[model samples]
Target: MGGSFGANLRRIRDESGLSLAQLAAKINYSKSYLSKIENDLKPPTADIAKRCDSLFGTAGFLSAMVTAGERPDGDQDEDVADDEVWVMVAGDDGERRFHRLPRREVLTGVGAAAGFALTGGARAVVDEPTLAGLRTMFGQYRLLGTTSSPATVLAPVIAHVDTLRALAAAGHPESVRRQLLLLASRAAEYAGWMSQEAGDERAALWWTHRSVAFAEAGGDEHFASYALIRRAEIAMYRQDPLTTIELATLAQADRAAGARILGLAARCEAQGHALVGDRAAYRRALDRAAALLAEADPAVPVLGSSSVSDEVALADGWSLYDLGRPAEAAAALDRQFPGITASARRARARFGARRVLAHAGNGEIDHACELAPAVLADAAQVDSATVRVDLRELARVLARWPGHPAARELRFALGTALRVRPGSGG
Candidate 1:
């Protein structure tokens, strides 16, 4: 695959009439590095493949070639050791740092009794009140996550998961232990989402697997199904539509899974179908998702985005764009987007960027430009990698009208938001 990728890259570059130096300058790689890649001296990184694909309009062929030869991420079933714990220390400058240390080392350093007590001893009992408080705190953290960067919110969420897991491991009543572990699973799941937002898919998968482990320990059988939906999302971002559909379908195969989980899976399947321009399949999956969502139990905690009043509708709008119905996509998004809560900055930014792309694709350059600044502001605030996907597409669509003042200005802002160099094609 590496050699094939190099051959394809060289062929594409030659056909585009670009010298090694010229291609290197365009993609921000060194001439020597490009030379090595062309000679199969080094495997092409995913980042370089994307840049080259964007420049050459290969439609992700280069990226596909690179990822096809990669190894699996690793085992997802391994559990964190009971003897290992995360320790946090406060510095003189008020900065906090966390470290993972063995229980024996901590006991030796802090005294056995103190260390045992700090890490939740066997005598520790978590009651309903404590669980309720933790749940409330988790809700607050989720709300905070909406308005902040993932990097800012991730550490505290991970720490909270560790604390909950520690408590669950202590000798407590069965009901209380189950609830504690369930909460830990939910926290771990959120941490996985934050990891993805932070652009670390490997960490994202690890956290998601941990979430499944915690949930199973708590006797919850449904979360593993939910984890499949999460994996499908990662595949969706990677543009692997078939894998996304496969995972989402497998998630739905668990009949015991809640309506919320099934609905989310169905929604993911719709996205996969849309990605491949299968309008009929996309609509069918979307309709199924909408019906399931309407029938979902509100008493249960929300499994996905909570800020959007109608998640299926928002997804439908985005799918329209994917299906190449850009005019209708823009209208659908315009109608649905304002209904999303203002505090859900990340969601707004993500859908807003898609709306911009839809409008740009429909040749409404001015309206697309008009819609871009607010989206860019939200995108900059949230610092989301997922939202940047659509923002990059919006930049490309706007690039068609290079001389239009609004288009050029929006392109510059998009470039800044994406942190791409000038003339890099984003």
Candidate 2:
């Protein structure tokens, strides 16, 4: 059994085209020690077997083969069915958060080309130029997402995340490795945001959880806190106000987080307060957010181009509407409407649809209907789930005035825009 295992290890190493010394270096083993194991003079430990499995993308095939040979044949496939792998990362409260991934998904070594990309855990090098490229790509993707449907960038963002994950796992100089992980964190957060916008709540949460883990592992407490705030934003979108408040509060408690993150947390908390009609608490949160923003640096740390002021205003509008101050919400939204660039179709759809709802909420059905065309157009163009949500709410309000031609027209437009059947789902 030991000889067979050694033969299998040697075969895999040969197939990978790595010399014994190089392979040993990659796996952090001495060459002579690995040679002894390969020649069956020394048996491979469970740790070595698992590392081999990960490196080869064999889904534990080698591990099972080696370990099973030592046991009765009947017990050979006992552990074969364990397809899920759980990764535990430290949570903000010092507890562990478990992220479960299918063994197949994380191990790209299933294919020949992908297997070659696995550099083990040794000193894999990703140059500064490559890191800079990833950052620039992230910046472009994020900027594009602000104005366009996130669906357009989701796949690419996920692919970029895979690259970063591979690089981080393969190892690098300490500083470069940390930056790579932070890059992964930012990409994952963007992916989560896109998933949420596209209406895949489960995917959104999954990516958000991954983002938090990556951020923490990368030693960026501030980014980790910001990820929680983003999770709170998702909660807000789901109309889960209590969860939103909880997550936002957790983020706020991260004293290591910078002012921008703190301000974002306060804004999210304020949104939750508004949702529950706690006007005083909402007011207090808004005031605190204002102060925090005043002290915040002009540029966002990760993505320097995002306008914090615009984000705050958008949050304010949403919260105001939730608080039943539709007039003020509509007014606030109007001020930022023109400033949102042409490419930010998703942003335009959300704010525009919200403004329509605000007008409808304030007994201005005619004006709300007047703004319906542009909102509907953007909704149809982007196919955004977030916009569809706001549009659905607006439809419910407009439904109250059946006699109004504008209301009927608006409802008809929304139905066409969102593909919502007359008696079916929202």
Candidate 3:
């Protein structure tokens, strides 16, 4: 139905040699707004259709919507359906992400979390079997963390990295030079993630720095760049736009880094620009990210793998949503979230919150609230400052909505999450 209406509008508008902005001018709306409507976002109302029809000398451009509205609300179905997800994650704002997962992801991620819990003192050796084990843990952890909120999920993440440090120090095992460094790299990332979820920016920074050092030492420039990305994330949260842009740019210059680096760098720059309200800068960064996305090669991604690829698209979508481009942001997220494996759950949970933000920006209150359950569940799973800060932001946004049945329930969850009452069953 959307295809038919969109085609009609596009055909009439384009054949008349009118750009989107030109048509928008005739209708007294913004070019982007009109484009969104044509793209099936804001279904044209009666008045809007009359104006468009009069201008195009055509009718029925909005017939699809008139017909569709007779049925049930589509936005209601757009709500995330992952019920029974754990709610242990903490958030600073409210962005939640849901990553795809393979069946083996949970076992691997849970094991790694357990291992790190037991061994926070040192590094680990990496034979094929050992690396494979950690890899599986990472894979599953990634998936759960992405889809579920961080509150329920962050404890295991903290434990996993701590244990990785201990595992790395196992009797100076053979071929251990790079292996130990890699272990540090992996541990650092997990530590950073946990700290970020727990609402401790200072801790998050510490872990990010440690992650960067290890990745560098291991000659994994790409992973090291990831640490740089997290550092920039801290800066963005602190409202230090200039600093974030600088750090993101520095990270971007590391050509040895993979596609993820380019995407993250662009995403950071976009976020900084958005914070400073620099529309031009934000658009340029977003465009650059979109262009760089084509360079992403298809790799054989399996379940329970912890390898870093591109997080740019998700980050970019977030930046766009933050920058008043909610409709485009939704398109970007829709494309980005489906491909990632479930092993990346923490990040995925954050992405889900982003989706909620997009819905809110688009005036879909019910859709946004309906998604609240999954996001809140992930919030319980997340325990990093990075994730927790996002939760805080989410709570603030939810607060603005004024009235809802779950308002009080969500408020309690947010309050409990924001405060660090250790041993209080947080």
- Per-residue lDDT tens digits for candidate 1, residues 1-426, read 335778989999999999999987665456997899988888886556756765676655676676674534543334446676444444565543444568566544442244357766546556777778899989998999899887678767876787777677667788888998898999989988987887767667778888998999999999999999999998888777778899999999998898999999999999987765566677899999999989999999898788889899999998877665677889999999999888999899989989988888777899888888888888887878898888887787677677899999888887777884212244
Off by over 4 Å in 1: 1-123, 420-426
Assess the local accuracy of residue 163 in candidate 3 as a C-alpha lDDT between 0 and 100: 51
Model 3, span 290-346: residue lDDT tens:
676556555823211243255656667776655445666667876887675555555
Clashes of each: 0, 3, 109
Local distance difference test values of all predictions, in order: 0.80, 0.71, 0.59
Could you tell me the TM-score of candidate 3? 0.56
10 residues in a row with least lDDT, candidate 3: 75-84
Q: Give the TM-score of candidate 1.
A: 0.75
* TM-score per model over all chains: 0.75, 0.70, 0.56
Ranked candidates (TM-score, high to low): 1, 2, 3
Candidate 1 worst ten-residue window by lDDT: 71-80
RMSD of each: 8.5, 26.2, 14.9
Q: Give the clash count for model 3.
A: 109
Error of 3 at 299 (Å): 5.9
The deviation in Å at residue 315 for candidate 3 is 3.0
Per-residue lDDT, model 1, residue 389, is 83
